[model samples]
Target: MEKQGQRCSGLVLVPCPFQGHINPMLQLGAILHSKGFSITIAHSQFNSPNPSNHPNFTFLPIQDGQTDHDATSTDFISLITALNVNLVFPLQESLAQMIKQEEKKERITCVIYDAIMYKAEEAANHLKLQTIVLVTNSAATRLTHFTYPQLQAEGYIPPKDSMLRDLVPGLHPFRFKDLTILNFPNLEALLQLIATTIKIRTSSAIICNTVDCLEQPFLAQLKKQYQVPIFSMGPFHKIAPPSSSSLLKEDTSCITWLDKQAPKSVIYVSIGSAASIDGRELIETAWGLANSKPHFLWVIRPGSVRGLGWRELLPECFKKAVEERGCIVEWAPQKEVLAHVAVGGFWSHCGWNSILESICEGVPMICQPCFGDQRLNARYVSHVWKVGLELDNELERGEIERAIRRLMASKECEEVRQRATDLKVKVEHSIREGGSSYNSLDDLVNHILSI
Candidate 1:
């Protein structure tokens, strides 16, 4: 155990570059730092986190050979493939250099990396340093990756429309349609990426950003599948002191607007950073919010709507409605927005981070999952957790209005709100002293030291 007033060991954290992935990795860094670990962040050049925000930690940028154009132009599979291949040598060299420099000082203990950055594990293994995999998504989502091969062999990969409504063989609460097999242009590449990421390799442990109460079943299954010690120490944002981790600038004015709204009267809407919509879907969404009775704060991320500038394609009637009851920004401080007393519901992409944030704040959701694990997360939120409603159909004004009403204004809303609040309380207990997450974090620290 780390002694009081003595720095224990140095850790190098490698985060995947996306906003959702970056937040938890950095928050984990913050938590370890508070526990007396010297922190070093080794990140890809693409979407590098700003060092100014975390002055205490050292930042090492690995050359990924990806320009801004490549990040924008390439498909998801291509980008990931490029990253996995391009980063291996550069990262190895960087770690080797760090090992040489820190030989006499606080020795580098282990490389804790995002699950997608498998190259980090290889690099650390070459140097005979310990490694840990940090899974940012829910345990249920990780289970899907572990079972992908079996799912494919069972003819569930290219899911038949006939089996869409049926539950997966062993994965309860997840229908065939709810699987994370996103419609990528290169299916083989995506499959390979999933296969590669699921391998435990030489890592010493797996750290998940989830609470035991939420996905205890799936976590248990994962424990049986992997030989390494699995730590469910999570809700990292709550465990660590808050910092600015957003790559996009957040519009703080929405919080001021939220202050004027009645308690639990506003519904916050954001589809997260990666998902994009066409002009038609955007129009439908605009009218849907306009028709719904609750005041709304919507984040229209720049370039998220295809073939149109931000809000330029919003119908005139919708614009008029915004003057009365809506506020739209390019991006929002989502955690802050969800935590505000006035936010009654969230219309989200059902990204794992978004779902956890909403649950943490006792805010229910209107789930509109776009791709990948989002559909699975949405299914769990609406069906398993009973804290949110899912919008599983095409975007239409009336449907959207009704979904919002169901989540915010209808009679069932209170039940869902209470459930969300109840879950929030459970999550709070999980992070308090002697709670599951707290103890898991302690165990994680000891495990790292043991290595």
Candidate 2:
């Protein structure tokens, strides 16, 4: 064993078993590793990390107690329930063993876990480890979750299907209907989990993947509610080194396709990893893409369509119409695609990572948020930031066509383009030396060392 002074303390990161969650957590691990911390990733077996990809970090897979059948389920609520129950014991045992063996050298210092994976914090507390909660989405998203109790008390949730006119406090310009939860099997259970997680997380340092300039008001609100040190270190992917943590096999062929397109002429379309569009909606979207007639690169990942075979859903005429102008792939190298010169607008699900990436690339957007924090994200994209336009819930071919046209060719698109570009520069600067995100990273590192 190396001497205590010579050995770097270890940090265990517990990310929720999803692409979005895993990417940021791995990025954080890479960031911390660069800052002289020994990185150990304790993850669920549901979506296990390839240890080969990140050789520097030790990967610990805790049996999530999920059978092959349950593991294959797309029902996120059930999966997370199983994880919350099954992860506690294996993680406890793993942490206990690591602490026992590594205390003399490279001692385990802290467990910084995903906000959703609060069970890891419980395990860490049982082992007397310093814990921090890593909020993987925008601060605005967390702000909404934190304010759920108030919304529920005011009967603002379980919103009506009608276009809501009433506004939720702090979530202005967004109607009550926009606050609906997605894929949650039990609403009460989800609420309880959020409340409990927020309570537990408040006791420690909270790290968010958002910059101060992006969500200053929300961050300020969070500070007012909780006394813990809130570190807004983000565009985490920008600050951290480049690494491939994507669960899906990314198709880099889109890059070559983009090289042939005219500058600021292509629309990059991705609905995110987990969202499943209805068969009718898929057809509508296809027609919309065809009607818009812009050079487009669309990612139609397997399972994105609800039906068993979605390839044949689009009409032959629609397919033929887009054949000359569109490139369809299974998945995309999103960051590189967004940064490409040909990508002028993004038709996105408004996932926080996607939002940041789009902002980083100065690409305006047509927001088609599906669920969870995405609705709120869309609100901010369209209303708060004025970088995107949100689509209605019902996916109509005309609406889709209009949105693409508006974003790609409308005169008003210039203003949104300017705003997106401005934010891109600001976001880039924030990750540079002495900027808000840079300073926050330093403060977070020092806090972990102190603990």
Top candidate when judged by lDDT against the true structure: 1
Measured against the true structure, the TM-scores of the candidates, in listed sequence, are 0.97, 0.96
Per-residue accuracy of model 1 over 194-285 as CA lDDT, tens digit each: 89998898898999999999999999999999999999998999999989899999999999999999999999999998999999999889
Cα lDDT of candidate 2 equals 0.86
- Measured over all alpha carbons after superposition, the RMSD of each candidate to the real structure, in angstroms, is 1.5, 2.1
Q: Candidate 2 on 1-451: residue-level lDDT in tens? A: 2344766779899999899899999999999898889999999988898888898999999988888999878666677878977998899999999977885458897898987887887898898888998888877777678778777787766655553656877777666766746435678877877776677543369889999889999899888877789999998889888888999899998899899999999999899988879898888988888888898999999989987557788778887787769999999999999999999999999998999999999999999988888888898999999999989669998999888889999888998999999988898889999899999999998888777
Candidate 2, residue 110: how far the Cα is off, in Å: 0.3
**lDDT for residue 342 in candidate 1, whole number 0-100:** 94
Query: Candidate 2 — which pairs collide?
Result: none
